[model samples]
Target: WTIAQVKAVAQAYGESAAMLLDGLDSGEPVGALAAKMQEAVFYVGDAEYRCLADIGERAHDVSGLEFVALREGSRWKVYPVESAPGGDYFVVEQILIRPRDAPESSPVIAIVDDDPLLTAEMCSYFHSHGYIARPYNTEATFRAALGENVFDGFIVDWLLETGTAEAIIQSIRQSRHGDAPILLLTGKLVTGEANEDEVARVIQQYDVKPFEKPAR
Candidate 1:
């Protein structure tokens, strides 16, 4: 495919992702959106080459399709023809997206608070905001979840049974999840029991906003 043709198709598929993001933001059903997105990608360059799936699997010269295959380890891997080695490939780009545990679900949020009442309230708020909230009473449970889960955000209380909020936030930021949004919640900030200046320093260092309790 020509550079111009490739750019057009890329733009179209890029818009597809944006549309899916919009659906998520609007609280639309993720199951439906994922089902639609999983449909066969058919935007090939013009009518020049017919885009086909499963061209008899191990065929060496699979034509009428817009893909090229490579043998990796013990398996044959396939990629779009436009992105294959040295063909008409103009460029290949990786689009960063929210990692999904299930294709049909909203993003996940993690809430770390020792108080069961506060944790439940925070989880309920996030659920109403279109995100699935996972709440933990201890850092150990939250840390265990990190092994198998990726979260879109974290709501952390300043004091924890296992550690201070600053230490917890620092640990999470350094972990494999990268930089997910961390919302710092503190009753001390409202009551002037904790040093606001020092707490603000931690926020400045971590680039996460300090949020006082939201109105119910």
Candidate 2:
């Protein structure tokens, strides 16, 4: 083939390929086109060309097509080309999107409360808010979970039957999950202590909720 004629055909094919690719810029669709092009450009010869030089000494001349293929899924897929009637159809490309797990879907919430009823209620509340709530009846269980799993936040009772609420708070404060937010729930400490100053102090010191009343 005349070098000039070969170059023109390659350029025309490249420009048309590029323009078609521009409309399909997502990486998935581009990859599909790349796979198809690789299938199309398979060769059986001893041609030495600059573009296909690296593929193998006897590979098909794919310098132009390779350039177009490389930029298939990118924003630069917008090159102009002219069409001739009855011309061959460029290879068809497709993208197949499938469902995958989200990285942030399983955020954990640890609830440190001694009452089984309270623990169940807290878990229900957190789950309602789209978090994975793991409730424990003792400081030991909470500590074990803290050691084994990562928690994004916590909901702790202000008073545990085994010890002061401070003990659980301090235990959680010292664990690897120390950075997690803690929402402390307390009975009406003196019948009416859920005031703004107390809530602010609790939120500032731990992270949200000086006290959420136990569910009725």
Best by lDDT: 1
Candidate 2 residue 111 Cα shift, in angstroms, is 1.0
Q: Kindly list the per-residue Cα lDDT of model 2 for residues 188-213, writing each as its tens digit.
A: 56665435454456567765556547
Q: List the residue pairs that clash in candidate 1.
A: none
Q: How many clashing pairs per prediction, in order? A: 0, 0
Off by over 4 Å in 2: 1-104, 191-208
CA RMSD of all predictions: 17.9, 18.3
Error of 1 at 74 (Å): 57
* lDDT by residue for model 1 (1-216), tens: 475665676687775434444544556465554443311223234422112222234434435445544444433334666544442221112111233345336788888889999889878766644578998999888889977888878888876766467878888888876588888887776687667887888889987777776634
Candidate 1 stretches with Cα past 4 Å from truth are: 1-105, 214-216
Task: Give the candidate number with the greatest TM-score.
Answer: 1
TM match of model 2 to true structure = 0.44
- Candidate 2 residue 132 C-alpha distance from true site, Å: 0.7
TM-score of each: 0.49, 0.44
CA shift of 118, model 2, Å: 2.0
